[model samples]
Target chain A: MKINFPHRQFAHCESGVTANLLNYHGFPCSEAMAFGIGGGLFFAYVPFVKINFLPLTTYRIGPGSIFAKATRRLGIKVIKKKFGSPESAENELDRLLEAGRPVGAQTGVFWLPFFPPAYRFHFNGHNLVVIGKEGSDYLISDPIFEETVRCPAADLRKARFAKGALAPKGRIYYIEKMPVHFNLPKAIESGIRDVCRVMLKVPLPLLGVRGIRLLARQLAKWPDRFGEKQSLLHLGHVIRMQEEIGTGGAGFRFIYAAFLQEAAGVLENDRLIDLSRRCTAVGDLWRDFALLASRVCKGRAVGQDSFDHLAALLSSCAVHEEALFEDLRSALVR
Target chain B: MKKNDVPQHSGLLSGNREVNYAVDVDGRYILESSVGWEAKNIALRQAWEAIADELTVVLAEIKDGKKSALAYHMVKNQMDPALLSQYSGVARWRIKRHLKPAVFAGLRPADVVPYAELFGISVDELRFVPEELISPLAGLDQVEADNS
Candidate 1:
């Protein structure tokens, strides 16, 4: 019989094994048997031997971005400073697995419908695990695990949830592989890919930039019904305006430019909707404000770095657009 | 164990011993050979390509007129076509039909102004706008500002 040890900070595979064995039959989360069994396993282990799935200890959450996503994965990759290409992440995964540690990572990338449309813009926090793999399918363990799953690495890269930010950024951890003789044979599967991603249900009006961006263009005008705190309401309108152009997907620039004309007028109103037609340039509102604020005030402020980072990403996107158009025009001529 | 000495199940199969022995050997051979599988994923890429092209044509038709502005809600995203149509004013059939094609063809149908309106901006200005920036959100410069 396998010897059982007391729970410790770092759990060994033996402990995990015993936990799995005793809990395997059918153990409830809050039961005395469950706690005594699982917690006892957690407490009596030495460092580097025990593997614990503690949410706060390993994972982190923050703003999402193309560059940040790449940097996060860099934390675990061997022999690399920058997680440069998709191929590089693959190489990193291979190296890590061959070395016997199973890694968990979250990419800013996301799938559409993972959240309501209002929560789509720049909202972060997605967790996923790299549960080894075979062939074209990467075995994954997600929080909403219903069954063990295998998905094409390429498809995972392309998921909208990755939000085009396809590298680990949110959360990360790893478990060292057991000795060969004692290693557990992988079972048929344990979890499903139908992830139950957590969604924070906040009031619609309280939702920041994205909410406002949608309302401005879709509503024809921002609603005055919310009333008072017009600047806050105006801020909501501005966010809606931004959403029209934010890095949503291809062919969105034209929509942003067109709607900017309408959203600006909304900003100038008593309720920010009456003069919605006259507003032609929405960038005028923040570009000067941002530049002047940066020059005048030398302190860090909330949304300051976010504003700059997003602006830079947006600019890069613009340059990419120019290149595509040039290529298209040249193609047409040829 | 050697080629001709099997006797345990032969008593049960006395009526047809030769056939049962042949069947057991064949089943074992098949089970061993099936340990690995052949790759057949070409079908998936082909399906995507066919679906994408058809979708682009459908999207072009849907955003042909006034509804072109609401194209963002209707095209390329993973949302249900019917859901998008509720907001986009284009019919759901058009969205389902055209979405993949628009994405595959490198067109953002949701951001595209009607072909008639494309002439409003100078070709140079059109050149200035990124295809990506053509979404209903960012395509309109003024709107992006407010949202930012």
Candidate 2:
């Protein structure tokens, strides 16, 4: 069974999946718009949580939130399910495909056979669309890749049911209803408000702008506390999360900047234009920090690249992000 | 970032292009495609180097008969006993015991099927290990992150 769904490749997964599903339902959402409306951008340096045996330093919020939040904000209705059994999940997915509805699935990447060797890891947060099935292979529209691919039924089952942190648990979702029209300005404003509020005012030192500053303070003493080699390893891990793991570089700051520009046009607020530029500047600072930290990771000698210097760069990002979010909060307050 | 400053490095994401928001000549934001970035590549290489170092130690232990081939395979997959046990449906204590060559050698075919299937290898090939140390993780002809 196959349906004629036009698939567009995107830089990130959940937002792309949201955009594609909404467009298919005739809602006509762009990826950046979906990301912005969903409040997709976030930062947290949770040192206690472990991924790949290192601290989890996520560039974005937890997986699956973008789709759920974006759909909610746009006033679209979706049916989502997580099945306890692989058999039931496969049956439901096959029924949906036979009914000619394209379904979005949350899957573990490690068991997905179509991924290139380098991209295969134990990450369970990857999102893709099951557009159709031919014989036993399911058609996949993975946003990160340039084109659609295919995975066999058994492998798809394994991916859907893979065990680990953030396991997908045979999850599937599809749009159930599309509104005639949405209050675009309202949605945009609400998204901007939520992001600004969380980034600036969250009480936990581990959560928001406070999190970045906390990371900065702790990073300076990592070499003394954890020793040089371990500190470099953590530095390298943070750099990868900041630069490599699907953030469009600089930790999605540029993406949010682009969103702010579009939000300005939609909301007819010129102040957002200035905030957009400042956000872009903050993104540049993060790129600078990542570049310096990568150097620090490479310069393994005890004091070759001063951890203090790297910490200073990170502190500047925290400083600028605090200012940018403060301005955004005030911009929305009026 | 400006459109010109995006680094098109040949690294981990070789042959695959990702979208970046860059400012064009008009200073308007446009989605630009990038092959890779140097800092990301370094970070990736750094991670794979640490993995490679761990695998090297595991391989030496495997050769010295202090550890079993399961130990080498586990390290290659970046799994410790707890993680391997989760995936393979083996108990943690049993996994630790199986990491010894003497215990692994006496195990029956049925006892190893879970692991062999978990790693997507045949029971016999689960014992396979590369002869030498490996390089960075991005791209390589010899150690291409494949268990097939």
Candidate 3:
């Protein structure tokens, strides 16, 4: 017996899953609302950490943070579990399905058979909902896909237990309780404030706006230091992380812009609308950056001057974001 | 991006195969499966090509007995030693030891089982590098060129 959970395709996984789960529990949450309330938008470029041998570039906060923060803000109680063995994980998932609970799970993308061949990679932080089990196949709602899909039990097991960076370890989470009413304005304000602190107030040079500037500095030197092929790969990785892998459109700048537009309506604040437009412009700049970077990746070298131009573009984005978030923080305080 | 500004393909072969998430004309968030999505796919394919090229070299090293088949599979699967260690529940040092051709040849079935399972291959298959591993991107270049 499966709970008739609605499957809606979304841009990003965690925020999408959080929105679907919250809606299933009677919250009627939108994806943007969930993302905003969770304070999901973020950026960090840590050269020391690597994913697939390239420097770490992330468009959103760490995996699972959105769901955790959103639920906490909205007063939704959730039960999260990680298993030591695949057998126990499968058993628990089956048990949950039998009890009519649509469980949210974190699994590696590489082992999931339903994903398009090109999209399948060894990304362990991918999130989906296991809505039902029929014999040896489990029905899954992967937010990135166009529709619901089914995965064989064995493949599901492999994906859930895939080893690597950000391994899920057979993690499953589900809402245990939902509040009758949530204070949307308070949660939105809190989310806005927190993001402002992260983007504008964070002191570390390796994070927030400073991190973007650092990435820019390093990007400018990539062509000279690593030569053409390696430099292109580095540039390609940055664009791939920004556009392709669960970015929710334009490195999450568009999503954050959408959130700001929604917040403007909710809080009846005109300033947020202005910030939303500015954020959208930043998203456009990121798109332009990706287009240029993709051209470089395809062996169409635009010369060394192109690298400097791209770095300047990134720096401008950082500056605009820093100012926008600062304004948001002060507006929320008022 | 605006709806009008969104890239659209027009020609004899005109259909959007890739899906993208963007805002629609109604100011509602929607998924637009458009030809523009292929741009990102091309980028992704290039990244994979680089990895496949590395794996090709690693496979040759394995075949020449310079490195073990474990090294070939690890590179083919886009995994590093630390990641393989986590997946197999094997200690990093032991995994490193198993990367030597001599050490890998002498490994017991029990020792080889976890790596095989992680790679979704049999023990024998894990011990021998496959032919496809040598030139993994053989036809990929043609497919990409055709797409462009």
Candidate 2 CAPRI assessment class: medium
Worst 10 residues of 3 chain A by lDDT: A113-122
lDDT (CA) per prediction: 0.28, 0.83, 0.81
DockQ of each: 0.01, 0.61, 0.39
Best lDDT among the predictions, by candidate number:
2
DockQ of 2: 0.61
Over 4 Å off in model 1, which ranges?
A1-82, A108-124, A159-161, A164-334, B1-74, B78-148
Q: Which sequence of candidate numbers ranks them by TM-score, best first?
A: 2, 3, 1
Model 2 per-residue lDDT tens digits across residues B1-148: 9999887876566457788877788767887788778788777777778888898898899889999899988887778898888778899999999999999999998998999988888999886777886543535433322321
For model 1, residues A1-334, the per-residue Cα lDDT tens digits are 1112122110111122222322322221111111111211000111122111101111111222211222222221212233435565667776765664444454432332222222232222343445566776666543222234466666544331232222242233343222223111111000000000100112333122222232223222212332322222233223322211121111112212222222223222122121111111222232333232232122233233433443444344334433432332232221
Segments in model 3 whose C-alpha atoms lie over 4 Å from true places: B8-31, B35-39, B132-148
Give candidate 3's error at residue A184 in angstroms.
1.2
Every prediction's TM-score for the first chain?
Answer: 0.29, 0.95, 0.97
What is the lDDT for A112 in model 3? 86
For residues A115-196, write the lDDT of model 2, one tens digit per residue. Answer: 7555566788889999999999999888777888889999999899887778888999999888888988888888877787
Q: What is the C-alpha RMSD of each candidate to the true structure, in Å?
A: 28.4, 2.7, 3.0
In candidate 3 the C-alpha lDDT for residue A103 amounts to: 97
CAPRI class assigned to model 1 = incorrect
Superior by DockQ: candidate 2 or candidate 3: 2
